[model samples]
Target chain A: MTQDAPRNDRPRAVNGHAPDVFKREGQVPMREYPKNAPVDFVIVGAGCGGSVLAAKLAEAGMSVVLFDAGPFFQPRRDFASDEREQEKLYWLDPRISDGDDPIELGANNSGRAVGGSSVHFQMVSLRFRPEWFKARSKLGYGRDWPVDWREMWRYYDEVEEALKISGPIRYPWGPDRGRYPYREHEVNEAGLVLARGAEALGVDWAPTPLCTVSAPSGKSPPCAYRGMCKIGCSINAKQSMLITYVPRAIKAGAEVRDLAMVGRIETGADGRATGVSYYRDGKWRFQKAENVVAAGYSIETPRLLLNSSTAQHPQGLGNADGLVGRNLMVHANDAVWGEFDEEIRWYKGPPSMATCEHWNYADDDPSKNFDGGYSFMSQGPLPGDFAGTLTSSTGMFGDDLLEAMGRYNRMAGLKMVGESMPQVDNRVTLADETDELGLPRAKVTHSFCDNDRRLQGHGRKFMSRMMRAAGGKNLFETQSTAHLMGGCPMGDDPETSVTDDMGRVWNVDNLWICDGSLMPTGGGVNPAMTILANAARIADRIIDARFD
Target chain B: MSQPFRTPYPGYDVLDKWDSPSFDDQTREVLRARRDPPPRRFLDPNQFALLEALCAVVIPQRRPEPVPIAPFIDAALHAGRGTGTRFATMPPERDAWLRGLEAIDAEARAAFDGRGFCELVRPKQARLLRSIDRGDCRAPEAWQEMPPQKFFRALLLKQIVQIYYSAPAAMSEIGYGGPASPRGYVRLKVGQIDPWEAPFGTWEDQA
Candidate 1:
């Protein structure tokens, strides 16, 4: 989609009457900063990470500027219930994806708007398994995160409380973090199928911890079980960064600029990040800041860094060790669909309401063929997405496609977020081609390892048994990947990682990479909550160092 | 159009909830736009005709009014709308569509005595499309930058399927509740149906 399409065509307050749904009350208007005057912190990408950073920094009384390439969509006015119209929420900028097993990079891994992919993310909020943070030491695989799980637990608790995550009172896996802020929601039929299968297979299944509110919060309503979680939620019930952190950032006096594409990080002769040069309002403008944070996620973050190569630093800002765009990871997100005799109209609640994280937590089990594991959930895909899955995932089309679609109500699905091993070769490099913005496009090269394939194969067999145990037949599997991570990884050693554990670039003193890009290894779960927790930790560290 | 397609929920019309709380005002606008699709903008006259024929084979519908798949796709391409990702091997969306249609037409002409894809019969078109889907591109020259099989899966069939399912008629055919906004589903357990939702059955009388 083009960057110029205005999202707010319909006014929220129509005829002096505010709609009961998506009530926008007590939202503080975002502050604006002068382009010439330097702000304390200029964060690129007002998404999950950027929004959190901006909120934390601004709340700490820093003059912050948050920028995003896409619109600041007010969901009540901008979003549509239709899938075709809602496709605008995705990062539709035509990034090149290539490898031995080429990844499909649109709706699954990217988003453009201020809220970013969280705007349309299925709200499967999960914590990293405590051992995954030290996978190298504990599990004998993958890179070890510099941050400890105990320290990360505080950040996760903060994020969970802030977002008001609705989850079980006592989570089965990991350390007990006490009760969730809100109670768990009712699991749908698709979730029941998963629960049934989990019961038969003797695996733990629980109503997933989700960012979508279960009880009514101030101004924002609770979830209405609309089943269109992958599209932008019209109601503010989804608790996206758009509604949660972005608003908090604004309220704390952060200037959130939408539709502003940051082109380069302006560095000075002193070897420090000075400000940022960006494209906004049909002209290239400079926003001077004391420090800059690249929270543009994996692809764009690395692309921006590589594009901002200076005379002093020829390779890139944080590419001293040449690890800026290296070690890109995407979870092996494949689905197994089956048909049953009974009507299993899966589209009733949030797509992933119930989940089984047994595989992810049971890493030491001798039955496991792979080093890492997966967490699969029952899926409630809308009709349009389901149809697309049928054609792309399976080669079902023509009369056969129509016949299969006729049995849409009878179908149930289980999709996995399996852990994939990170290789340096799987990376984001600058392509020869340029985008409409005249910036070098990011060419994401990714391929699954043997461990990844084994994990997926194991997941397929596990899901098949579950589906059959739930009396589902004619099962078929579809291969795909989701939740991108690790381009500018964070570690204790600068030579081994792009950024420090606190997300500071080793070479660039004032610059930071504060997003999922800092994630050294993506755990076997949805990465949103973990990303938020990482951002919170980074923000806290930045705040702590600010007074130093 | 005769009612030949067998659907479990026979009489469920999603459009019936158009005036209900199920659909919000923005959803109504989106549906209206789809119902009255924009004229073909990106595809040339030949390509447009070919796309229409190809879509017919892809999703052969027997409705009172078939969904205008080709026009919607052409409009999206004209507007440079994408899901924001593309295969490194393939050309851009517009180039892929043009090259794919051209290559498929070339295949049809080669297979059926120099007649283009639009001139071919339904069975012939289906056979040609199946070949393209299977990566057996006879017209290698026609597919310059884009792979035939990739164009079929990633672009052509994907767009067609997505567009078809976006229509209200397709929603009715599949027994989908149109748009749950102000009023959403409550009874989400097994064998429980919301009063507004379509009942489960394959009875012919309902159709």
Candidate 2:
């Protein structure tokens, strides 16, 4: 931020209008909204879920206003294109961490800007398998979704189509035996290196199925593989909500006000949803809307619901059972590094090039030491990544550090996406610390269970053996967590779950949630694609049932 | 442009062989500092000299140039850059740094013929470091009271190496292209190299 901070202050004026503009391709679109405008639907957070709902509702001829605390991210115009300046994208206000296995949080956990985490993710969009829906029945530990994957298959199809997702002709172990919209990405150098390991272990591996466009489709363009996927994508390659849903919503006459932080969900005397009270530019503004949707992802969603406690529902909005912030889950992730004999420049393409889902068939094999299974994905950090974090993690610093760094090109790694058990203790509560806006921060407490240890231990040994078989030496492991889920789960029981089958918050008539927070179980894969699909399905329901 | 690095490993050309970089200004600054680092603002001249010696022995570079490592650490410390959270095992960065420096000098004087750490040759420096690493430091009263072994390995050695390798010169020596942001790599297929990538060896290199 010190060197290449974005100059959002100097917005390009358009047609003698004010600097409030959405520069699409080249054309600058602008409009002025009255302070007290009539709003039919108000969606909180302008990330993947919120942005998708906004686009869908606005397209169906409804007056919608989407709110986000972060500034609009115009990659081509504002991005520094450097990883050092990547921290500007993450939501790093203040979040607590407590776990037996140490996982770094700052830039890795959540993204703060317009498109939210989608704008700064690796974009490995794996759909939830049919068995994943009935996790509670199968695992005998977690909770099951009220509606199964059969009910939401069409929405998944629609999202894959809309996003132009590219993949192999078949995902042998995919959900609903679904085919990808486009061709899979070509196996990059990292994938090739991982292939050697996979072949040695007799494992099946393929190019990772990603929502990121592999070729030009409609308004979306193919990925150039900048290797900064976990950072903000500078080119219009990665199909985040910023380029896809957010812009579409704007085109459909939705007002997206940036830097507008929502304070509380305003409710009437009869416990009916009215509008939202938010802080924007040193003022508390209220926009009256019939329906209010909270799509602020996992951390903020629970925080918002708990913080918006009315006198009627004293615990919080839809917190009658006091189960708003519980069952916090993340992929029990581990990164294993392999120093090879040959050169492998991993910084060029996508870091996560391919995945081996051999161990992820959780339904068939229930006799495992771990409750759930794990998958292996490529982990390709750049030179700066090595010099900063990896080398420190390797425990070889100073002169030994230079020697280890000398093997930078030869070094390749893989992240083990092991499933984590959702413990009641692993929860997010309101911390005593309040932000500048007097809103309480999400106090997080997470720990690995015995199953987590077994999963990671088995995975670490398995990955190391594969690496060695691939003629790799000096194998090392760094413990990490990715794709956080749960907190506000969706189920039939209002006493246990926050939302119902349709992602509607229990006991609240016009309140809805369509984000990772609604996930009952953190599947063995990434949760973003499922979040998108769930949002689409909920948006459809909202469109059908126009409020009375 | 500078001549390519005569790297120790084969199967891949040195990263410096590339004519241009796709990274932004901050990356350029990081690379530039590796060769001609700015003056230290945190550590005094004595501490700076000691750190330079520590860095040299820690990551012994045989380059034609004096590989810059310690200056970045000095700059980072001067800027009061914490690593998000402090280690429960270690003291504050600046205080720990000073203690570690004095302890290193004490060990050097005790081992060598009354010579400070920086005064010793590279081999002698390595020997002194190994002693500190093994928690064998019997230091003077001037040295801060701390766990010698943990301090050396965790903070002193790890932090410095991280700073050193974060530069372009260090990465180029090992064939790294750093951060590719605006101009992303397109040739992602296996066994195919992008036009801008380092010339890698065939399947023969895999063996």
Candidate 3:
């Protein structure tokens, strides 16, 4: 079991020496490893799953070498108390575009930091709907997983405990609810409005299960409810991979090499994974290991595999099934804005203090034409973002329009997030273009089908009605492309999926994948919980295999 | 004269309240030459004058205040570069497209002679803005192809909304604390939440 370090503990220099004289302040230290140093395991991508797996495997007496392409983010040191400083840290890569287009196609703003995308996302944790695992059987659209939800429940419980997740046990508005494990906070206005609106429409609305630290569960502090949850939390109240798993992994004797880009995975003639080849500080390095795990996100993992071509598997490593880069999924999101007569003061609390899980599960009701559900975002925009979004919507110009904006600070908004079924066409491939690093950046090509459009339309209508019921005027709906699932899918059939029950690639032994890419179907709720659960499950399997 | 004035400061013309120098040719030239105009950039003097007239009509300077319209316009045009080639060249193109706009403005001024856009009798400025929004150019397609309606939308949104929101007064109007305050808050939240929002449950839960 991991114990919390003293509150004032300073980060120990690697290899038990003083801080490197050559290293810049706040820069991740570089280490020279002997060529082909043998390790028990090599975990690629130091995000959530890779960090967890590294820690777990290391704790089990294995020498783990973890690599991430981004720098190791020293939160307190690298971040500032000011919000603008924070935006600069998060959005400094000028190469990352910000328009409503794909990054490969020149859209800005996706996380490319040490902790990967997690370093820049809104912390919304949710478990996969049980049906998500068996979506192929129920939805008749995708392949079913080799393992059922029950097999992953133990890992889910373990992850929740490890992460110190605290929430009411009985899910609000859930069927057959049990006693809550912890006290739940009162719903915020946005959540309350959504609940009331859903009730008025005779739709079920319940408290959203979030991973936020509302009250002290372990060493983490309780949430102050500042409503700025989307930004990096200065108080460590919001859990991120950098704070939670990566630290624990480092403490447990795992060596993390940030800014180490893995170029290819090396396998033996027998088709078992041996190690990985990577680039760091202008040199090629190979680390041999008994096992190799790819925990890079959906886009990177498949790209890595496809890029790693070998004589034994020329199409790609573990590409015998030709399912390496197929079946991508992303949620369809619609936002609705409602101008209120009274000030809402939305910037004072978490970006999402409350969400309605009322429509998380598919309904067979005759009145509802779609099978997907929606989650309601309670917190509206922060002042600047709100101003930007609001002004963009309306054709407001000049100082006069600016003066008009000051009058309506308290307007509220809602976002409706719906799950999209997996489709082979929605994919992330290597773009014709390459990045400064010479790696082919991920080219994402995605569009919604008629079913997705129908779901969004229905969801928008329902959300608009709810806003009106909540005493809001000038209700306007905004559309957004989702940034959720795809790349790697899990199943028993090697012909259709990349990984097996434990996220182990079907064709390659000791090569596991644990990230959003493994999700077979995108659920309406956030995927953080499921990702952690799946990572934990994979770790357990690795432990049971006695790879250490 | 007996009608109740809608404004809080009746007869208080803030337009006459400023002491700053009016936008002059040198200032305009300096602002115009800031960046090498994108290929085929087209904002000429007459078109620029027309754009200024249109902006003044839409958001007239208020009284008893230092409302710097030129600075605002300069900033808006500078910031609007590369938003698209069409928008970047709008100031120059305004002269080429001046005839139709002049006709429209004449009609608008006729409808409400001395009253500003806000003070105008209903539907006058609205009618003009609607025409501009709709790309209602009377010129032949040969002379100057009215830029696409989409280009106008981008220009309007960029200049009117994006540039306006970036200004300090405009920020105050919307209660925006600039990107420094609330954007930072959202960034912090995103940092905390983004990683945790990954498929993994939470940072601590990952193992």
For A1-548, candidate 3 gives per-residue lDDT tens digits of 00111221232334432122112233333233344777878889877778778778877877888787656555534443223224422322112122222222101123444455566556665566666677668755455666677776666677766665545556654333343334554455655666666678776655555555667755456665545555555455566776677766666767777667788898888978788988776677789887888888766788888878788888887677676767766676677877665545455445565566666663665656766565666654544445445544454444434444544444567786677767777776565545445666555556666767777887788778888988878687766544557678877777778888778888787788877788887777766777777887878887897854
Look at candidate 2 and give me any clashing residue pairs: A398-B58, A398-B59, A399-B58, A399-B59
Better of 1 and 3 by lDDT: 1
The sequence of per-residue lDDT tens digits that candidate 2 reaches over residues A78-139 is 45545544556776554545445434454666776677888888888777767778877865
TM-score between candidate 1 and the true structure: 0.96
| Per-model TM-score on C-alpha atoms | 0.96, 0.82, 0.72
Worst 10 residues of 3 chain B by lDDT: B196-205
**Candidate rank order under DockQ:** 1, 2, 3
Interface DockQ of each model: 0.63, 0.27, 0.09
Segments of candidate 1 deviating more than 4 angstroms: A1-28, B1-4, B203-207
Candidate 1 clashing pairs, residues 3+ apart or interchain: A92-B84, A93-B84
